[model samples]
Target: MIEFATHRNKDPRLSFRVLDMTVKNEENLKRVFTDTELNPGFDKVFSFACLMWTSDHEQCLENIFKLLRSGGQTLVWFMGYNDLSIVYKEILEMKKWMAYLKDEPILKYAYHDSMDVKSDCYNLMKKIGFQDIISDCERKHFKDYVDIYDFKVHECMDPYVNKLPQHLQREYLDDVITVIDRHIKNDGLTFDLIILLASKP
Candidate 1:
């Protein structure tokens, strides 16, 4: 994705730098772009399908605000809710998997289960000092069969599978397939995709 973005850049004045939002520390965050040619403060920022992986939304947004120059805008896209997360949450509660996944508390689909996700996100952004924040959640319906194989290799499932013994890994994946099969409604899944557009003061 980074390579594609860089290749499509036709303007010499605009440059792209990568920040590891997963990193929570100031030093590690600085280390990523310390030697880059771009000066401090970006005019725009973007995050695609990335915020769900972050454990700290406040810190993440704060970092983005800090990276941007005054009046800089940002667009963030991420999953809102889906049956896949329900399947994963069920798997987390399974007796056999509990011991292996005891340390895992935060779900990748973190705020999706909330009763009012938009308001929650809006409040967070407001607290972070972003202006003109818009948090929109769109519910999308799918008609295709659930790809059991693809999700088994997904990052959301990998953490749980990685913690299990190699012998139990395949079985766990099979169990996930079983649970997913139970939740599939007419061979399709509904999803909520959140689009957040905001700007720094």
Candidate 2:
């Protein structure tokens, strides 16, 4: 966490303020930089969020570019595209079951997939002039590559559910309950995916 204030800034005496920053310095910073997401901000940008959503990554890189000086550095954490696609394809098949879960709040769209969540993130960071872009997809890094929350079905359970019209939400809640017993005959745990880093280039 290298912090330097120029002559015109609020803390203008050139005194470095490391207060409230993570790690001791950049070298120590490497100890904690792992799977995360980025959010754009005006000052120094540090993210510990997941990279499952590409739009968030794009916005985070844009924020890092805007917040830092020309030589300033940022470390972004996220998953690679390959690991996510496997889970995505399975989730893609869920598109066929809309009639059973469409009225369920979380699955209102039933077909909205924010594809290219990784390639798009990396591209956005590069366009923002991040040069040390290193993608480390060599590990099981992401925690939730595919959202499988239920009461009805998986995917789009967060904002999608909250975004639905209240009256239309309950229209399909219990409908899928009866269908779920027949849906998972094997009765087992399924694997999603895990991707590593996609940083600036």
Candidate 3:
């Protein structure tokens, strides 16, 4: 939650500090960074770190290197774009997809852009100056992961079949209604989520 001040530039309390998140919460990001009394060097920053989709990995690593005592550990987590289409296709089968689509328009646009950015998580991390890239597929071997569904149908199917033609959109969507019916019963599955863990070593 970011509180906006109309005259933030003149605020005396405004300052910056680097922080690491050990837990999943990020509502306090602006607060942690803007505290005047904080210093990444003096504070025992998070030993376990997490990187989110919005975090700049380079800045995170740089802060860890500069502020953390040597041998201090930071864990960064980020989302990967590889096979994002297929993964989203699977997620559409889940109940959460509808609620998400109602609020997110850029997600579909980003999905379109991802087609050409073939650098999977590992490759992109390496390009950004990370080392010790490790791609882990172990989660696929376990059942704890959420089941996936063919969500791409929602993204591309409309343009694929409609293309400004209203009749065509309805025709395609109606046919999908049948497939969706069976899917709701757990009969549909799609996509692979590859988890890659990279390090600074």
lDDT of 2 by residue, 156-178 (tens): 32223333456645533333333
lDDT of 1 by residue, 4-79 (tens): 7778985887556677775567676567655342255778889887776566778888888877877889999877
* Every candidate's lDDT: 0.76, 0.38, 0.39
Model 2: lDDT equals 0.38
Best by TM-score: 1
Clashing residue pairs, candidate 2? 36-49, 37-49, 133-200
| lDDT sort, best first | 1, 3, 2
Task: List candidate 3 segments past 4 Å from native.
Answer: 1-30, 33-103, 106-119, 137-184
Q: Which stretches of candidate 2 lie over 4 Å from their true place?
A: 1-43, 54-60, 79-124, 138-159, 166-201
Model 2 earns a TM-score of 0.35
Task: Rank candidates by TM-score, best first.
Answer: 1, 2, 3
Candidate 1: worst 10 consecutive residues by lDDT? Answer: 150-159
Q: Pick the candidate with the highest lDDT.
A: 1
